[model samples]
Target: MLRLVLAVLFSGALSLPASADVSIKRLFGKEQRALNAIPQTHLVSLLERSKAAKVSSGGITYSRDWLAGQPKQSGGREWRCLAEALYFEARGESVKGQFAVAEVILNRVSSASYPDTICGVVHQGTGRKYACQFTYTCDGHAEVIAEPRAFERVGKIAKLTMKSAKRPLTKGATHYHTKAVSPYWADKFPRTATIGFHHFYKQPSRLSRN
Candidate 1:
């Protein structure tokens, strides 16, 4: 009697599900084919793009979309100084790189070794030829802003970076230079993150006369 009941139940399950089985298999097949059509590299690229689009609580999003959502920003001398520094030094860098440069400047502001303000940090060694902290200031050529759009973007970055609560990007970096040349001071300071064309550094706490 138990054998007969088990046989009936098995036969019933087999006989009633043809349409259901086909539907389930077809749906799974379509999804599998869709996934298989995407190349592995392409999938990885998509994941990276998605992560870039995410707005972080740290207030530094590396996506143009995040910048577009921000209101137009403006400020006085300090803001202008930071904006100009970024434009001349890192306008062509990636968004993350520009922020990294800004982080270095801001970090200098908070450190005892450098000036407490953005403008002061930027123009620390101006007025003498080849002696300025920033080359653009002492380069002798006119600081003509040929690219207004690029300047505007850096200006926005400057504004946001100033208002950011923390400087986590460069880890309190106080100095940075492009990878093109190994500056005399590069070996002295501890190397930090290297972003875009620049390598960032943090000076020793006591500071050096170089």
Candidate 2:
């Protein structure tokens, strides 16, 4: 059953749209509109930074500029726990992949064994030396948004996720891994979802479900 489902998702691997991830739709909340809503000031030469801009996904349109006006980060003014998770969790991945990883995180947030908040879930594996989760943040490597085009694209997806765009791709998964590394944990986990090169799993959420 898992193989059949995964094959279907992987075969039609087009760029995922905002309407594809359910957890994202619940978080972003439907305020994001307009293509050129705002300019990327952080990327402007005035800030001595590179310029960032929006990209259309063939027939799909997004609100990258609009999101620029809402600078949410882990520590920034618009700091949304989910938004921060999306930025760092999969910033290096394609927009769809980034969102895919984020859905896993959100799935965890809503699960019974993990932290209810995104920050807690993200930082859960931190400070354990080699025992931390989300290998990218604890691997002694800095997270840099080097690919501006891709980052901008993911950033927009992040914004859309914050604005209630729904696809529910992760199926309440709180864990994930890239296809390249066949982590031992993968063998132990019961797969919940798979999108692109990522696989998601659930180990329960921490929040009390009414």
Candidate 3:
């Protein structure tokens, strides 16, 4: 029976859609005894170690030493877009602020209402007056990437953010504005948190609209 259940679990895991959470959990339930044999704290530690390894391998250790280390080569176009957005938008803000901005950009990408790609989300409404999502993209000033250190720092942040699928800082926020200015849209959304120079918000639910 155990062998048969193990076979079913493996087969179900392989056959089901990767995003099918329910089916995956159902299959996992079949092996609960085996999984439960591992210590919970040990499992959590292993997961943490795996996440740290991914962060380290991407040349972002989430530390000053790593940021001060020799910069890795600039990544591909998607990475370049995200890094540029962060550099221009939040370079002067605290590191946590930069991450928060990056998180909002990424959260927008994942959201149904916004573009699914980073560059698309970052550069949305490029030519329209007072219509761009990110101010730097449409401010009409040449985007001269003059600050090498700042660019390098944000590039690493972007790389790590894309590689790690978790967004811990923003609490599912998809929008933000600097403390210097309050946008009208901010009042409609639920304020999530304030980090550094920026204020974050999550989209309001359908019930909230009514």
Candidate 4:
């Protein structure tokens, strides 16, 4: 089942041209070949376009057919920030790992210890040697967005997650480390799961100050 889910996610993030639309019609259904594919509006449009909906021409007030449980695209600024960070930091990561990375950032966003917003979470401690949440921000080189393709892929994932798509891949992990880093925090948190080049960990909840 894990491999199956991973396969589906990887297929969603598969290589496509920068202008190519990566959408639900491409991933989930086939009828709506050229539907409007905005992350926030696509799903709603998708249901309207597909035959699965029960649109009535017979007239009943002014109501459109609704899907029971369709996934919505995320449009909030926090979702965008999370997407940008994932794109910049983990575009090379596997699909499962990409979501896990986003989870860590979101976890930090909700934690009392870190910033409450995605931009704040990603840009925390700027200018200092190792200040930014994303190392690329503080690294010597400018954060050049050369790969529009990769960024779009990450953006879609962020949109989906922000819309309440559940990713149970990580075990509520707020931290992760690549196989290369051996930080002091590693031993402090319990190891949760390993996906691709990253290791997920959950920290002890011993803090009293809120």
RMSD of each: 11.8, 16.6, 15.1, 15.0
Candidate 2 per-residue lDDT, tens place, 89-166, comes to 666554445666766666656666667766777767777787666765687877676666555555555555544444
The local lDDT score (0 to 100) that residue 83 gets in candidate 4 is 78
Which structure among the candidates has the greatest lDDT?
1
- For all candidates in order, the CA lDDT equals 0.80, 0.55, 0.78, 0.64
53-89, model 1: which lDDT tens digit per residue? 3335555667655766777788999999999999998
Name the candidate, 1 or 2, with the larger TM-score value: 1
lDDT of 3 by residue, 1-210 (tens): 344567787786787686986867876785776767878766644543343322334344434344556457577889999999999999987566787799899998988788899999999989999889899999989999999988988988897788776877789998888888988878888999997688999987552211
Candidate 3 residue spans exceeding 4 A from truth = 1-63, 70-73, 207-210
What tens digits encode model 4's per-residue C-alpha lDDT throughout 1-210? 223444676586567555555563365344333233345345544433342312143111111222112233446678777877887778877555676788777777767877888888788877887655577778888777789766766776676555443445676777788899987878878898897689988766884211
Assess candidate 4 and give its TM-score to the true structure: 0.61
Worst 10 residues of 2 by lDDT: 43-52
Supply candidate 2's per-residue lDDT for 169.
57
Better of 1 and 3 by lDDT: 1
Which portions of model 1 show Cα errors greater than 4 Å? Answer: 1-58
Which ten residues in a row are the worst by lDDT in model 3?
48-57
| Count of clashing pairs, candidate 1 | 0
Q: Rank the candidates by lDDT, best first.
A: 1, 3, 4, 2
Best by TM-score, which number? 1
